[model samples]
Target: MWYRISSSTVIWVANREIPINSTSGVLKLTTSGTLNIFRNTSDLTPIWSSNASFSVQNPVAELRENGNFVIREENDDNPVSFFWQSFDHPTDTLFSGMKLGKNFVTGQEWYLSCWKNSDDPAQGEYTYRLDPTGYPHNVIMKGQNLTFQTGAWNGVRFSGRPKSSGNTMYTHKVVINKEEVYYMFEQINSSVSRLMINQSGKGQRWTWLQQAQKWSILYEVPSDNCDNYNICGAYGDCNINNGPVCGCLEKFVPIDVDAWTKGDWGSGCTRKKPLDCQKGDGFRKYSHIKEPDTLSTWIDERINLKECKKSCLRNCSCMAYASLNISKGETGCLQWFGDLKDIREVSEGGADLFIRVAFSDSDREKNKATFIISLSVVGGVCLLGLPLAFCIWKIIKKKSKLKRSKGILQGSPKGILRGSSKEHSNMSQKEDPDLPYFSLTTLLHATNNFANSNKIGQGGFGPVFKGILEDGQQVAVKCLSETSTQGTNEFMNEVKFIAKLQHRNLVRLLGYCTDEENKMLIYEYMPNKSLDWHIFNEFRNKLLDWPKRFHIIDGIARGLLYLHQDSRLRIVHRDLKASNILLDVKMDAKISDFGTARSFRENETTASTNQLAGTFGYMPPEYALDGILSVKSDVFSFGVLALETVCGKRNREFIHSDHLQHLSGHAWRLHREGRTLELVHQNISQESDYALEMIRTIHIALLCVQQSREERPDMATVVLMLGSNGELPMPSQPGFFTEGNIVGSDADDNTLLEGR
Candidate 1:
């Protein structure tokens, strides 16, 4: 019969027909290796039996650390041939080293079922098991109905669980081998803790306190109502900060407004404008967002952040994506193809989500029209009284001519070449008679009639061609483009400004030929071509290692330092960039293409203009927005070029999330997060110890590009910072936060606001 250990506690006996009803009822193993129970003085009964499957002479049962009771064969030391084991028939508690999924091949299902109650040990309604359906994920069930889930396991953690830190009490591991899949955890130090699936279908951890001889609650899964099954319904983010604690994304609105207002948000939300692939649809990046569920349809584990966007954009079905594993250099990509469900805005450390939007050309045209109208208004206000200004300009021109003629008369040469006679006659009347003039025919023949193959490169001024004179001297001939937007006045301005300047870093103007349609400037031919060709080209980028790259960066800085401070005229190369840096055969960098160059008096700091012109990405925010040009304009462009050199990527083509439009802003974010190393190009050698120094250079480049002209560092200080080993000042936040477009503003007001 069954024995009642206490009047309130009941214990079961396998062979209950025979009862041992004495105080000396002892169940003991005899020397014959047989276990028997003796009740009274002469009464004996067989309470239990063991038929050890092993042929070994001896066997014994022991409780393992995993809490499994197994009888092992002494000689074979094999527990597989156990006569009896608690694992094959489990009790109420499923401890650390337990298996909980089905053994499909063996037809043996291992699961954790809750007890009827604390006082009863019968099976309960709730059960937990690992589901191997579309993907392997954990599921809890109550009476065959899905109750809770632990989401799919990413490489690092469960997808549903928020990333956790500062939990050092235990180490956890989830293993899936050929035989079974299980969840387990080990204590960091010797502490008594147990995890249990309670009677009410809740999972919890409890730790024992030896002094109090009691158990203390540690943690519980499925912590809140949002954690309940689809509580906010689909495509709805749960936020504890909000009143109702649930809402749709920016471009989305509630599908059932009445239900949502009544606090019944189960129907969730829908898109305001349905995505149409035919239109110019694009993704809007949502940062610090908990990615949605139901990702099995669109997840790709191999692409990078850029590639992930491309993959999503290419396939119209993909709605969003987040990093599957964000810890170790973004190992995997998780994308959502259709509907996004259970999204949340976390306080910190969440992935970015891109949502699709309708694309319409009319919207673009309207934006362009608005920009032109605004520019026209600003330009008109700045250029009022134009005819009166022209009269003043003519009077100045007359006085300038008189002074030039006086200088020409004082410096006329004795000899003039034969072909240059009548043209030379015109030169004698000109103001600057000592100005060297080369014949158009001579320059044309010297440059092989400006052959296409001989053309080295082109700038705003024109195409530069390689040539060899009769004396076997190599030179580059820059022929002004006939169809160029720049006029003769701008060309003459450059010739006049750069002709008198002489520096090793500046491209020397050998001579100029202006006869009829042929206008060309000749200079010493640089064999290595422009710096952009080598530094930015994918195949050639590797040639510039850290040492060579740093050397180039330093050389360019020095050249700029000379232009801004050391030179007699405080000149600014408004278009300073990699394309403007010409490299000699030895790769010595020389600044070229001074078409957009400007000069200032010694005491002057900046100049204002209504015209806005420069390459798109290289233009500083202040100069691009408000037509205020200054030395800082050149500084901003240099910053972009410097970053491009380090990463071997173009600023315009850099692909961060939709929130971050350019490389400078992306680099700034990573730098502030103390993860600037992630910005280094993958091809850069890791063995080098200059990574930190490279980051410093990148920081300085960012400082130079600060949106406010006043915020940018001066050239003198930039040169010193680059050359010195001293500690650098912290840089301010860069331009372009996660807001609307920052374009279409004027330079003066923009610079002033940014400085404030």
Candidate 2:
């Protein structure tokens, strides 16, 4: 029985099939060393017994502190000396230090079985156990049917549950060897926790809360609807965040399109181009996701990832392969055969799976061959001495076409900025001399027709894809979404604004694409993705040290400075948040996404609009409420971003244990108490050299986020404060510090406010 002292919780039962209805019962150990429980007053029949094979000289039945009832020799103190234990045959709950797996030598299996119902203690339909088939992994079965899996162990934790390794209450571990394969968890402190497969077949982690004096659920497997086995069917990936949870992999299409459209993804998907094993096949890498189910799979502990790919390629039956050990640098090989099943996209700490696909001709290689032929033709042209006048005319014609294409977006009234065509032309000629216009066909070839695998991120505008151009240059393609509320206005606005403004801290827009219905903007890709991916993430935040965080803050400030003061136009970035701030290869930050931005003449200071557009947590009080937009609006957002960078928390999502205030309010409270240093994240060391700089940065950020627009410093002044160690004024109260003050309380990022 599990310990509660008041009422013991029944953890396991040996004789679930037989019910002992009589009140008269006797539990005793006989001379044969068998522990038996008799139900009748006559003690004629024993209901249950621990049938020991051998008799001990001095037998003892002792209940260990971990709730493992054992039978062993009285003289033996070692745990190995025990002949039988309750932990070996767990019914529904698994306590700390209990092994959940198999012993090959004895052919004994340890598994958890759910109760028939809340009231009854009989064996239920669901059984949770280690499936040691291809690779050892935990799975739940509904009788004989495999219903759910915890994914294979990936050196740290289960591959499916990416956040499992971050739990502080217990340390989860798996042991795999020739003799046995098991999974267990050990308590980190005095906290009591248990794992149980309940009547509903959900595996839940229950922890005893001392303050509440009750057991509360800490975590659960099959947590989301996506965790159900094969929920997306074969060759499909489940993403709970998306509108339609089930989607096919790249180079694949739904087998039954009509059924799939009606939300019936059970038919799954099939390859668009059938694999030709005779010609050979290649693998397409899908990252940041749970590897497919490993039921029909093989594992080679000795082989590396390269060898695994080669091995899968040689065998036409092998559909996918993944590295077994993700914590370490690519160790062991795992190959899956037949249809790949039960794959899902995880937010963090996920392994990469390479799915086999037909080896198609690459456009880059073709472009290289064409380049060589063009070089040969140019040599012939030089030798022939073409007419100078004809060459000039050809160059002028090309220039005219380029200008015509540039003006194609100007026809949309909503998209055009407050400038004449001559003004735009002059700006384009002066700044963007190398802006190339990519054809729809070229982009289609580059991004595999907007494959899901190529998609890097999704915004209010549309999905952004990573593509490699013909010259092997990688670019980020932002294609306008058909369903997006933001129409041609925002898309053309970004193209026009960024094309004329060039800076090291700004994300460079390479070109634009217009193919009838399709409109896209091509940009230089940032490999590190966005700042939020690192600064706000539990695992990734550790990679950003105080110095790297400071560097990002500095870079963002400089980018803002360019927009506000140094640029050709006095531009105000209406939408500036952590996600819009992208990080490059060296982790240097570059400001992006200028969809809602507006430009002002030298005399203009502020503008008003009936329509409001910006993220919730970052929006300034005046702009969000009254629709008054100015350079200070972005300054307020910068302050929030700076604070988030230092604290490693989201402004809106942050919760303090001591108070009900949001992140900014908590920081303000700490600053008032002269405990500002406590606001830093645990990852940042207090004794680091940049500790003072961090506090100073927080102080500056506070000044920027002041409630009064006049109190907040401009972007130019904010940049100076970041770089210099100077005296700073006390910050006034920050706007929307309390939950009550937040507009449209339920509003999230990219929220719209209807103006009064």
Give the winner by TM-score: 2
Tens digit of per-residue lDDT, candidate 1, span 598-636: 898998887777765566567776676666788888888
lDDT of 2: 0.79
- Alpha carbon RMSD to native, model 2: 15.8
lDDT of 1: 0.64
lDDT of 2 by residue, 153-210 (tens): 8888788875542467888889989999999999988888889997767787778767
Residue 369 lDDT in candidate 1: 77
| Per-prediction CA RMSD (Å) | 26.3, 15.8
| lDDT (CA) per prediction | 0.64, 0.79
The 10-residue segment with the lowest total lDDT in model 2: 410-419
Q: Positional deviation of 199 in candidate 2, in angstroms?
A: 0.7
In candidate 1 the C-alpha lDDT for residue 165 amounts to 51
